[model samples]
Target: MGFSVAYETAELISPALQREMIAVTNELSSDRAWLSCEPPLLMNRGGILGGASKPNFSPHPDELAAAKAAGERDGTLSDLIQILCSVSSQFDVDWVISHDCSNGPLGCIRCGRCDPEVQDQCQVLSELAEELGGCDLDLDDL
Candidate 1:
């Protein structure tokens, strides 16, 4: 015979909390295993068990940059980019960033609202995109 249990994100608690919960459960059954998973990308919200209060959310420029930096530090970004490039080359499809923002891939800057600082930031993103052999797609087309 087999048993199954299912729960929603609201039921997920912190690791320490989980340990306590597991201890309670273990008293009834000692042969159970536990697993946990987190969202792949940096979420704008909804991290807690009950979910975020805001209905809409998106990644900020700084958050995107930090995520990129962390990925590069861990070598995950490089590995993923290499794999993408190889696959894209095989299919002859150009790799590009697609989004609704006017700034670069990170989507931080507005086109007409560009100040000196915004220009510098956009320039940096453009250079980075070029270095990666990818370009930002104009969201206006979509």
Candidate 2:
């Protein structure tokens, strides 16, 4: 298994959900629970109205092996999902856009160079290049 990034963009359906997410973010900060390689980055970022949790690098091989040896488990998408699910009752989300595996056609190659925890989530970036269709995306901007 290897590690890959997990990114999710959510659309909050209600002001109450936004407030709840903000509270959760505050709690995460206060608890100093925003550890790298484990806890994902959760917040309303990039001028997005709702929120997102983008785990840059998760299911880290070293961390996973260590945890396994220690009889524990490493972080995965499920971990990120659980964090959001905690506020599921109070959070009304209309939809969520998820991106896992490599960065995209402009990024990773699925070389298996890194053992991925969620192999199913990993996809060939080139296959997604078509989704860009006729969009003009400057490489430098990306």
Candidate 3:
């Protein structure tokens, strides 16, 4: 299959979807309801050119496990990326948004604070990644 950059900020948010990524591994959980109700995780970040910051919550792993745990799930990852894409799109002017998976709520994954949009994005991305096999799943299409 061929691939084209679906989201202009793909590189920026790619880290959250990185394979077996350790950045935000600890935050995600097996609870689908939690993810849906409150988003996956938060992402604390500054400008790429600025100083490093805290981590955030994401849904990459939990969703992957859920999908694998289940049988059929397609919108999982897309839901996530859509959220991310939306936030990135909105923040396109003020900041360079991405899925850095850093600086969230906990110490494991991206630990810090993130906007609701980023959290929503991560949740959607996580859901999609999970259904698609997470890291092994190629979301380059987005």
Q: What Cα-based lDDT does every candidate model obtain?
A: 0.28, 0.40, 0.35
Window of ten residues with lowest summed lDDT in model 3: 47-56
How much is the lDDT of residue 109 in candidate 3? 12
Question: Residue-wise lDDT of candidate 1 within 1-142, one digit each (tens)?
Answer: 2111111122234555444433432342222111111111111123222111110112233544665565522212222223323333433323232123324332111221223443453355445434443334432244
Ordered by TM-score, highest first, the candidates read 2, 3, 1
Order of quality (lDDT): 2, 3, 1
Off by over 4 Å in 1: 1-75, 98-102, 106-142
Alpha-carbon RMSD, candidate 2: 12.5
User: What's the CA RMSD for each of the models?
Assistant: 20.2, 12.5, 13.4
Q: Which candidate number maximizes lDDT?
A: 2
- In terms of lDDT, which candidate is stronger, 2 or 3? 2
Q: What is the lDDT of candidate 2?
A: 0.40
**TM-score of candidate 1 against the unseen true structure:** 0.21
Per-prediction TM-score: 0.21, 0.37, 0.24
lDDT of 1: 0.28
